[model samples]
Target: MDTILIVNPKGGSGKTTLVTNLAGYLARQGEMVNLIDTDKQKSSIAWLKHRSPHLPTIFSTHTHNFANFSVKPSWSIIDTPAGLNEEILKKLLKKVDLVIVPIQPSFFDFQATQSFLEILNTKKPIRKGQTSVALVGMRVHPRTITAQQLEDFLKRQGFPIFTYIHDAQIYLQMASKGFTLFDLSPAKAKTHIEQWQPITEWIQNAHKI
Candidate 1:
């Protein structure tokens, strides 16, 4: 099984949104997917409970049993709380195959990711092939300068940013109505469908490495 950790050190960075949709998309693709909600807020778990039972999800609060859980599902996606300390984050990192840090295209979000990187870097040498980090730009406007600047800044900092999710009313609308991306309108569904390709490709490649 492959484990993907979705994390960010700041709230409103689209962590639950990313985790839920990504899990839904992957589960639809026929992979047995298990979602572990480590966030104290339990937002992802609540969302899953409210949504259709088509997707398989498991809500977990204990980080200790996380790594050893019999992840029968081929993919295990973990949604962790924002701003977790180095000690806890390091322990979680050791359990996952890849770490995905979702950040908004804003100075505050960028600054927040710095602390997360610091925690990850502290375990760098020992973490060589054990894990990889990917920066996801969420709720970004198409032509916004902030988006462009964030893209450039992340690149300059040598962070591996793989994809961008545009600011779409469909996401919020669906969430408010207790629906997943699959339940969105056709146009919105198409957008997510297109964006998911590269994300899944990168995930697959990370497992191979």
Candidate 2:
């Protein structure tokens, strides 16, 4: 199974949004997906509860144990807690194929992400290139100064920025319904779906270690 870890030490960085959508995308593509919620708040778990029976199946276990799954999963998406300690991050990194850090375009978020990235770079798996890391700009408005600043800031970190997801109420609406852009008709979510293409492509191409 391929594992993807969505992490950011800063809270409200859109980690849960990315996790649910990514899991939904994978499930929509007919991949067997396991959703893991490591956050104390159980946001991902709550979202799973809201998932409709007609939608593509995504499995989860309350114990957070990968071995105990309802069905064997081809993909595992882990939503991590905020302020994650180095010891736990290290352990999680060892098992993941990719790490996605989502950040809102704000000064405080940028500062917190910068510090997190510093520690992330020092992890053994990352230093050895065994696991790949990427950034995503969340809740951004296009052609705005804040968006430009986010691009500038992330570029300096020397990691790939897959795409910028704009500030849209659609995400909230979908999340509330246990859905993602991928779960909707193409006509309704074309733009957002296009924005996620790079991320999907990267997931397909990323080597599992």
The CA lDDT of each predicted structure is: 0.74, 0.88
* Residue 195, model 1, lDDT: 62
Extract clashing residue pairs from model 1.
Answer: 9-83
lDDT of 2: 0.88
Candidate 1 lDDT tens digits, 1-209:
88888888798898889888878777666767888887778887777767765544433333445446555577888888876667677677677778888878888778877766666766863357457778888898978898898788678655578788888887877775547675566775887767656777888777676
In candidate 1, stretches whose alpha carbon ends up further than 4 angstroms from where it belongs are 54-70, 125-127, 183-187
**lDDT (tens digit, per residue) of candidate 2 on 1-209:** 78898999899999999999999988998988998888778999998899998999888744444334332478988898888888788778877889999999999999999999999999888888888999999999999999999999999998889999999999889877889888899899999888889888999887333
Least lDDT summed over 10 consecutive residues: which range in candidate 2? 63-72
Superposition TM-score, candidate 2 onto the true structure: 0.94
The candidate maximizing TM-score is 2
